[model samples]
Target: MRMKDPIPQFTDIITKASKLNLAYLHLLESRVMGAEDCEEGERLDFAYALWNGPLLVAGGYKPANAQRLVDTEYPEKDIVVMFGRHFISNPDLVYRIKEGIELGAYHRETFYTSSAVGYVDYPFSPKYLASEFV
Candidate 1:
């Protein structure tokens, strides 16, 4: 999966898109790549430098790390962190993150099964339901 400067082609696409005044650029990164859980960190500094506008990054980001990226890493730029698989496992994702509650685990096996098996079958945290936000 390794290649020498794999970004040239993508950067060229971004260069063309940048001239069109796009709203924002989306980037996907994760410590977990597909079925393998990797400890390697994500490096999107090139994307940050390429796109001067808003950037929406989605991956396996916990609340603290996401906040740090926005508030500290690129303080001067507009960066938004998005959650995908986590949201499927944590319905009250926002509330749980805000209250520092433990997040739920997802059933990867049932994911994308063409049914609601894992999509809408997960349980919610009782604490989140009892909280004032509910």
Candidate 2:
């Protein structure tokens, strides 16, 4: 389908527990800044940005007045989850459920789209164990 504008069109926004808080905020901003500019068929899309690097890098989505929206506008629509980096290393996250394993911290130097700085180099805890034994 051909889109009228350069921006993408999305009916729903998905977010995880880590993303839940911030997703609402970004949505609020988009509604405030971009909604007015959007067309009738165009609804603002919002999602929580994610980062594996460092403890401070974690972010959650916070939909603005989501409950209010359901009360007023879209009671049937529900946002789905589209986890980013968190799912990569923790593929069995759904199965583990309550597994209390410690997650590896990501290195900030390789977070961008450049080379694989934080991509693969951020060793998992197992690697740390092997190194410690050596």
Candidate 3:
């Protein structure tokens, strides 16, 4: 499959987008896509180099790595790490990450295979539920 457009064309698109004065750029990096992982060292160097404004980055992001990425990877620019797969299985993901609780595991096999089984069957952390009750 021919994935990449010519550099000149891509640059033009990016250039136009940069000039739009948009609030922020949402970059879906080719790193960890969906339930499948992409190539090992693929970085969005092109977009990063061009888009200097705030960036909302999306992909497979766990709690720790997400924090570390914002702190270490691009400290200069305003970045908000977006989570997808983790959030699906973990309804109380924010609290879990905050309290260092183990996250609910996501089953790849069951993904997109069931109505309630894969979607809403995952249980919330017992601790989280108890805290909510209290």
| TM-score (all chains, Cα) for each model | 0.88, 0.28, 0.78
Clashing pairs in 1: none
C-alpha lDDT (0 to 100) for residue 85 of candidate 3: 69
Model 3 Cα shift for residue 67 (angstroms): 1.2
Candidate 3 residue-wise lDDT, 1-134, digit = tens? 12565456666778899999999988765555555765443456677778889989876677777787788877887889887767888888888998999888776677777467767778889898889643
The lDDT of each candidate is 0.82, 0.35, 0.75
lDDT digits (tens) for residues 70-115 of candidate 1: 9999999999899788899998888888888878888778876889
Backbone collision tally, model 2: 17
Instruction: Give the best candidate by TM-score.
Output: 1
lDDT of 3: 0.75
> For candidate 2, lDDT tens digit of each residue in 25-113?
22322212232322123234332223111111112212223334434454444433232344444444333223344444334334466
Candidate 2 lDDT (Cα, whole model)? 0.35
Clashes of each: 0, 17, 0
